[model samples]
Target: MSETSPAQRRPSGELEASVLAALWAADGPLSPAEVQSALGGRLARTTVTTILTRLHDKGAASRSRAGRGFAYSPIQDSAGLTARRMRSELDKQDDRNTALARFVSQLTSEDEQLLRTLLDAADDTPQRPGTGPQAAP
Candidate 1:
């Protein structure tokens, strides 16, 4: 992975995913200045602007002219974005089920038992009420 820049680093040095997260969680569009104010960080206004423009270019945000500034809204809300990202990651895995199985197998005994219990519970759970099985006619 490429080194994260100061402008893109979170309080914990992770990439600035939370900034995009915040904008996506907001109820309406926001200018870069508004984003900066909402972030309440040491980041320069330009840094926030750069991040927002990058998001727009990546198709993550929609931008519209608002007088001299551009108002940006998240193209996908936070939940949608998270689902998209999760699906994308799963797609990139060669064998997602196998990976999960290996991870579960490698867990401590207690954790492994917990995983088995959870899987058993899931297997015992019934399908949705209106879907799948129905009573015999």
Candidate 2:
């Protein structure tokens, strides 16, 4: 068999993840060429474009006219995206309460304290209409 190319050997979604990291690090929207450059040119310009288009389609990114092509920006910053991913995984659980209990049980003391502090602060904060964690679904 022919030797597998590094590109072919790359794990599924790795390229898209790298592309998303580049987008997240960027101060503003980036074109495919810029994204490719940001990734140290490991990916082809076409590949970056494909990832950006996929992100846009999935609502993880937004794009706008930048000359003949589009410039893309992540819809959420890194923290928001991480939280969204956590929520997505949590939503997939058949035993959500058990999953949450296990998750909380594994937290380090500091992390648990921080979570509590955040929760306390959130509770103390006034909620605006249709906003905040306390808002009705």
TM per candidate comes to: 0.53, 0.79
The candidate maximizing TM-score is 2
Tens digits of per-residue lDDT, candidate 2, 1-137, equal 53357767978878788999999899999999999999998777877888899989977899999999999999998788889889999999999999999999999999999999999998898988889865767
Residue 59 lDDT, candidate 2, scale 0-100: 78
By lDDT, the best candidate is 2
**What's each prediction's clash count?**
0, 0
Q: Assess candidate 1 and give its TM-score to the true structure.
A: 0.53
* Residue 17 error, candidate 2, Å: 3.0
C-alpha lDDT values of all predictions: 0.76, 0.89
